[model samples]
Target chain A: MTDWQAFFIALLQGATELFPVSSLGHAVVVPALLHWAFRQADPSFVPFLTLLHLGTATALVILYWRDWLGIVKGFVRGAVRGRIEAENERLAMLLLAGTIPGGLIGFLLERPLKALFATPRVAALFLILNGAILLTAEALRRRSERRDLSREEQEQQFKSAQQITFKAAFVTGGAQALALLPGISRSGVTICGGLLAGLRHQEAARFSFLLATPIIAAAGLLEVPQLFSQRGPLALYAAAAVVAGLAAYISARFLIRYFRAGRLDPYGWYCAAFGLLALILLR
Target chain B: METRGNPALAGVVAALGALFVIISALYAFGAVSFATSDPGAAHHYKHALVALAIAVACLVAANVVRPKAA
Candidate 1:
């Protein structure tokens, strides 16, 4: 792959990786639309892309080091004391539960999903459908309430991670499995699932990010072996990966703050516009 | 809490918005082409390097400038 291709793909990886829109969908669709020479089976291209994902996963870990550190510290302390701390122990268990569904689903279907990744047009169609999912989710959140509480009151209800239940986490995990398809946004779907479970927007977004940590790491671990089989200039790929990681980290920081204070409507609108554009252009 | 506007914070936000725009434009335009011709290759690589350099410079500047909180 050329340096330019690496840079663009890295940028795409960084931006869409955080945005509710699907990054994988963009990765698959953009190259196909442009008729780029790198095929899905190209050894150099696959390794190069895998390294970019590693960069993104690294960025997520660095960006959320505090959360991950808390889980680890909590687990170790609980083990030493032979009693679980409620907050820390609950968090650790929640993460474990959230990861199980996707891990199982992905392992069983990895080969078939790999085949789906090669179909850009199908991914594009799914991207549009993913937008519809987000839109419907937002509407559903607007309609439901615990009782007769007002909209603002309802929004204030689930402000923290403590409010999320074990059932909600499992549902979010199942939603994450949809990410196996290219156009489905892992973060978007999980956050939507959280909203459907009656969690507030910021709370949903936070849970989505926390939940994404392990999954992204697992994806990198699976791809690392394949990356080692390639014969490209490893240094250049490493440099690009570092650049992508830093970009992703900065993007994640901005997004967390944005989701906290901003409404999801803008992201919804963006997905709609992009999905429509993809349909038109790809057609 | 005090609600005064901070010029440095404003600058940081403005800088971030600009960075977002540049990156979005690059993706929208397919400016990182990897076509197999010499000119196409040069165009693609040059754009990538420029974007990487700009992104890194902006990040460093954001860190060093210590934008005062509003």
Candidate 2:
């Protein structure tokens, strides 16, 4: 791919990666819709995509440095004392619990699911379905008299990561696994799970991002090694990765803050509009 | 102007809008092609990269250039 092509994909990767609208869905559909000659089986494609994800994962890490730092401190302090700090222990456990369902399902179905990546029509249809899901989530949030509570009030309603039970994480993780489908968004589904579990939007968003970091990193770790095996100059890929990473970091920061203070209606509307347009144009 | 609470959110939306506008304009004026074909792949990739750079830069700038406190 040309440098310009790489850049656009990087930008798309960065922007869609964070948005509630599925980035993978767009990546799959956009190329196909544009009649790009990208072969899903191309040796370079998966690694290139992995690099893009690495960029995004790195961005998330940087953007949420404070949160991660706290988690690490909590973990280390708890470990040294031969006892887990209640908060840190719970946070770590929640993350692990959230990771499991998606990890197992993704591993078992990786090959079969990836084949679907080539078909943009399916992705488009799924995008429409995702739109429906988001609208449903908005409806649920609205109907529930869950007044926009203050942060402190919100805290009282939900337990911290450490306090979250295994059952809750498992459910959220199961929801996350659905993101394996191209248009089903990881954040959207997981956040929906969080909200349904009675966590406020902002809290759910925070957990979703935190949960995403490890999963995304694991995906990058698995795929990035392939780039090495193929034996290309790493510099260009590194530059692309860095560009993608920076974009992702900024995007993540924007999204976390956005979901915190804003209503979900705008995103729901956007998804509905985009999904409708895709169906009309593609079909 | 009430500039508290969701300024970051507004900035992101505005930035995304600008990107859509530029991309749409390029496609409309024959400056860029959105069709799916061999040449289109090259065009799409190149245009997408430029768009990505512009979008990323705009977002970063938004984060860095804070609005004056209301």
Candidate 1 chain A minimal-lDDT segment of 10 residues = A76-85
Residue B64 displacement (Å), model 2: 43
Q: TM-score: which candidate is best?
A: 1
The runs of at least 3 residues in candidate 1 whose Cα sits more than 4 Å from the true structure, single-residue gaps closed, are A40-43, A76-84, A145-154, B1-70
Q: List runs of model 2 lying over 4 Å from the truth.
A: A73-85, A146-163, A231-233, B1-70
Cα error, candidate 1, residue A42 (Å) = 4.0
Report clashes for each candidate as comma-separated counts.
Answer: 0, 10
lDDT by residue for model 2 (A1-283), tens = 6677677778887877777788888888877777777854466676777788898898888877887887767545533442333676546546655765565466446546756554677787778777788778867866654469764454456544445555687699778877878888888888777776767677777788888887788778657557866865466667778888877777777776776556566666776677667777777
Q: What are the per-residue Cα lDDT tens digits for candidate 1 across A1-283?
A: 6888878878888778777888888888888788887665455566676777788888888877887888778645543443334676556546655665655465446446756564777778778878888888887876765557765566776646645675687678777878878888888898898887777777787778778877776566656766776678778788878877877888778877776546566667777677678778878
DockQ agreement of candidate 2 with the native complex: 0.01
The superposed Cα distance between candidate 1 and the true structure at residue A86, in angstroms, equals 2.3
